[model samples]
Each structure stands twice: as structure tokens, then as C-alpha cells.
Target chain A: MKKVKVYVTLRESVLDPQGSAIMGALHSMDYNEVTDVRIGKYLELQIEEGTRDVDTVVREMCQKLLTNTVIEDYRYEVEEAVSK
Target chain B: MKKVKVYVTLRESVLDPQGSAIMGALHSMDYNEVTDVRIGKYLELQIEEGTRDVDTVVREMCQKLLTNTVIEDYRYEVEEAVSK
Candidate 1:
């Protein structure tokens, strides 16, 4: 078995309204030191087979369907699972 | 300053297509023991002033904007940051 971790984040140039709102709320709550907030996604995948090519496949998947490359950036890692 | 951590996950009933594709790829790679993959979002907010009410405000923000409560579940935590 294999495990994959994927991270997706909005491009720096994109406007993140949710992040902005959170920043405003934080400031109002007396957490004035918070200058910014960035929101992103994470995914954990469990695969059936363990293979060296898993990383490449995962990365391709992220680029093709998991994220909008024009507005988001994604990265992933694959690890072989140890049988119990 | 205060820090808020938000975690958002798809409802159990929702079909996570990206997760499913990743699972399929893992199986093809020889990691056949894997059965499931759940994808989610995480947000970290840095606040300016530290206050007791931060947690409540952060939770409200998550409910209102950070996640889709009908299809997703979210939780948040707040911590006072130590000055460097």
C-alpha cells in the first residue's frame, strides 16, 4: 500500500475574499498582529499498490484535475506503507 | 498576536472524485491495500492582538465563509503567539 499527501494553495495574485474576511475578524477580536491569512486544501490518499512511479502519477493528477493551475499551486508526496 | 487553525473536510456522504482517482492510481501502482481517501482544507490565520474572544470569532468565520457547512465540516483552534 501507498500513502499520498497533496497540498493545494491559491496563487499569490488571486484575491482570497475568505482569507481577507478572516483577517478582518481577527483584527476586530484584538488579534491585531495578524497581518494575513491564506486558505488552502490538503488531501490524504491511500493507494493499493506501491510503485516508484506513484509520485509522478500523483503530480499529474494534481495538475490535470485536482487543482486549477492558473489560480492554484499543488504539490504531493508518496510513501510506501509498511505491512503490519 | 493570536493564531487560528481551521480544518475543513467533505461530508461523509459527498463523493470526492479527486480522492477516488488517487485511490485508483494507488491501486494500479501496486498499493492495493488502500481503501479510502478524504480531501480537506486548512487555513492558518495570524492575528494582531491576543484576546479570549478569538476562538468564538474564528469559529463563526469558518461557518460563515471558510467552509460550506451543508457539504463540509470545519473546526478551528486559537492560540496566543509568543513574541520573538
Candidate 2:
């Protein structure tokens, strides 16, 4: 099997309300050292053997469903899964 | 400033309902090559200079708020942030 690690983040031009809320909460909690926060999604996928060219397949999946390409950017790393 | 990347994942012994739902969706969409899916959170923090021992502060933040240690595990990477 192949293991894929995906990171999805809002585009830089977009505003992230959830992140801002967390940042504000941290500040109120006395973590004044925090300058900014950006929250995103992380996903891991295990692909069965013989899955069509892993790279192409994963990229397509990200584009089709894993992310909202208009507002988010996603990148992934693929590795061979170790035997169980 | 320092940039910190935090990754939170469900512990191996814990079940992930969200991941399972996504996996089922992918299968219904004919991505039968997908064997497993795990979903988690990614956070990026910009830390102000002079923060008391960044490592200590970030670990505390992760343990206190960024993650739920009961069923999740978290790890982080810190790097020097580039100024705008």
C-alpha cells in the first residue's frame, strides 16, 4: 500500500474566521506571544496496490473532492506503506 | 518571529468517524483503490519574538488547547518565520 499525506489550507488571499477566533481566544488566555494562527486540514490515505499512478490519482482526488480549489490549496506527500 | 506547524491525529487505538465517512464517500465515487482514510487538524502559529522558550510554550498550547490528548496525538515543527 501507499501512504499519502495531504495538507489543505485556505488561500492566502482568503480570510480564516476560525483561525482568527482561536487566535483571539489564545490572546485572552494570556498567550500574548501568539502573533497569528491559520487552521487547516490534514488527511492521510492508504491506497491499495495497483491503484493507478498514485500521484495522478491523489491529485485528482484532491481537486475533485478533498478541497475547494477556488479558496483552498492542497499539497500531498506519498510514501510506501510498511507491512502490517 | 517563529512559525510552528502542529499536526493532530486520532490515536491508532481510537476510531475516526469522520475519516470513515470520507472513505465511504470516496468508495461510492468509485475510488475503490482507497484502502483507508484518516483526517486530522493542521495548525500554523506565528509566534512573536521574546516569547518565553518557544518549545515550552508551544507544547503547553498543544497539550492545553490545540489537541485532545485523550484520543489524539500531536506533534509539531518550528521554523524561523520570514518577515514580510
- List residue ranges in candidate 1 displaced over 4 A: A50-52, A82-84, B1-34, B47-84
Tell me the TM-score of each prediction against the true structure: 0.59, 0.97
How many clashes does the backbone of model 1 have?
19
Each prediction's RMSD to truth = 5.3, 1.0
- Estimate, for each residue in A16-82, the C-alpha lDDT of model 2 and write its tens digit: 9999998998898889999899999999999986838989889989998899999999999999998
TM-score of chain B of each: 0.84, 0.96
TM-score of chain B of 1: 0.84
Model 1: per-residue Cα lDDT at residue A82:
60
For model 1 chain A, where is the 10-residue window of minimal lDDT? A48-57
Give candidate 2 regions above 4 Å deviation. none
How would you encode candidate 1's per-residue C-alpha lDDT over A1-84 as one tens digit per residue? Answer: 787777788987999998888778766765555677988888877666645466665776677666899999887777775666
- Supply the DockQ value of model 2: 0.89
**Per-candidate DockQ versus the true complex?**
0.44, 0.89
Task: For residue B25, give model 2's deviation from the true position in Å.
Answer: 1.1
